[model samples]
Target: MKLLLRRPQQSDIQALHQFFFHVIQDTYAKEGIAELVDDQQHEWELKKKYVAMDLESRGEKRFFWLAVDEESNKIIGTIECGEANEIIQQTIKEDLSYCPEIGTVFVHPDYQNRGIATLLVQKILTTLEKQKKSSFCLDSGYKQAQIIWQKKFGQPDFILEHFWGTNNHHMIWKRALPFQL
Candidate 1:
C-alpha cells in the first residue's frame, strides 16, 4: 500500500477515533487486561478533545500526523507529539533529555506489521528535524503496543512501575535522529 502523512484534519476525526479504539482494544487484549477494561468511553472523550483542539488550536507546540493509505484514503495510523521539554522537566523533576514526547501512536490492525508505524515515526522525525529538534521520547503501556517501538529503537531510557497510575508498567524509549553528514 502506498503511504503518506499529513496533519490531521476535521474530516478524519471519526476514523481516527475508530483507529484509536481498535488499537487500544488490541493492546489491552495482548496484555491480558481486556478482562479489566473496555475503553470506548475514554476514546469518546479523547475524540471530543481532539476535535475541539483541531478547531481551536493551531497545534503550535503539538504536532499530530496521520498516515494515509493512497488507495483507500484512510488514516491507518497517527503520531501525536507534545512540545514539553520544560513541562516534562517539571513533572519528573529532572533534566529533559528529549524534546517532544510521543504522546500517542496507534495504528489500525489491518495496517499492522506493514511498517506503517515506522513510516509514521519517520515522518515525525522529519517534522522534528524541521523544528531543529534532535531527539524524541515515547512511552507505552506493556499491552503489546510497545513491542514495535522497543524492537525498532534502542532499549528504553527507563521504566516506571504502575506508571499509568494503575497496574500498568510504562517503558520510555528515546529515538535519536540519524546523523547528517
Candidate 2:
C-alpha cells in the first residue's frame, strides 16, 4: 500500500487519538491483557499527550512521523523520538532527560508486518543522524514487540526480569546512531 509519511498537524489530533486507541486496544488483546482496562487507558492517555506535545511544541519536545494510507488518507502507523519516558529513566537510574528515546511505535492492526513501522523508524533514525545524535534508547514490555525488537536490535542492554509480572519482562536497548538499517 502507498503511504505518505509526514509530521502531523493540529487538525490531525482527533484522528490520531482514535488511531492510537484502536492500536492500543488491539495490542492489549493480542498480549492477553485486554482485561487490564485501566492500563490500556493510561497508555492511550500517554500517547495522546505525546502527540499533543509534538504538535504544541512544533516537534521541539517530541518529534513524530505518521504513516497515512495514501489512498484512504487515514493514519495507519506512527513513530517518534524524544526525551526518555518515565520507565526508561527509572530503569536506567540516570539522568537521560536530555537524551533522545525512540518510541511510540504503533502500527494499525491491518497494517502490521508490512514494513510500515520499519520505514518510520528509519526516517527517525536518519533525522537523528543528521542532528548528530550519538545514540537512542528503546524499551518494550509487550512480548510480541519484544520479539521483533530483539531480532532487529540484537540483545538488550538491560532486562528487568518479572518487571510486569510473573514470566513477563521489560527489555531496553540503547543503540548507537548510524546503525545499519
Candidate 3:
C-alpha cells in the first residue's frame, strides 16, 4: 500500500476518532482486557475532544500527523507532539522538566510490523530536530508499546510498577533528538 503522511485537517476528525477507537479496542482485546473496552471507548471520546480543541487552536499548542493509505484514502496511523502528561511529568521530574513530548502513536493493526510506526517516529524526530529541540519524552502505559519503546530507546528512564494494576506498569523515556534520521 502507498502510504502518505500529512498534517491532519478539519474534515478528518470523524475518521480520526474511528481510527483511534478501532486501534484502542483491538489492542485491549489482544491484551485480554476486553473487559476494559468500555473504558477504552470513553478515553477515545475524551481524546477526540482534545484533538478537536487542538485543531481549533490551529496547532499552536499541539501538532498531529496522520498516515493515510493512498490506495484506500483511509487513515492508517497517527503521531503527535505536545506537553508531557501528568504521570510522565511527575515521574520523570527534573529530567523531562519542560521537554516537549512525542506521543499519540498508533497504527492500524493490519499495518503493524510494516515500518509505518517507525516512519512516524522518524518524521516526528526530524521535525523536532529542525525546530532545534534537543530532546523529548515519551511515556507508555501499555505493555506492547513499552516493549517496542524499550527496543527503540533502551530501558525507560522511569518506571511506575503496577501503575494501572498488578503487573501493568507505566514507563517514561527521555531521549536526545538525533541529528540525523
Which candidate achieves the best TM-score against the true structure? Answer: 2
Residue pairs that clash (backbone atoms under 3 angstroms), model 3: none
CA error at residue 135 for candidate 2, angstroms: 0.5
In order of TM-score, best first, we have 2, 3, 1
lDDT of each: 0.69, 0.92, 0.84
Q: Which window of 10 residues has the lowest lDDT sum in candidate 1?
A: 83-92
Off by over 4 Å in 3: 95-98, 179-181
Residues 81-158 of candidate 2 have per-residue lDDT tens digits of 899978888888876754689988999999999999899989999988988888889999999999999988999999
| Model 3, span 1-181: residue lDDT tens | 8999998899998899999999988888877787986789786986686677679877656778789999999999998887777887787667553477888798999999999999999998987877777899889888889989988889998989999899999899888877343
Which candidate model has the greater TM-score, 1 or 3? 3
Instruction: Return whichever of 1 and 3 wins on lDDT.
Output: 3
Query: Which ranges in model 2 have alpha carbons more than 4 Å from their true place?
Result: none
Compose the digit string of candidate 1's lDDT tens values, residues 156-179.
676777876686777776556652
Residue 173 lDDT, candidate 1, scale 0-100: 64
Model 1, residue pairs in steric clash: none
The regions of model 1 sitting more than 4 angstroms off are 38-40, 47-55, 84-92, 95-98, 162-168, 175-181
RMSD of each: 3.6, 1.0, 1.8
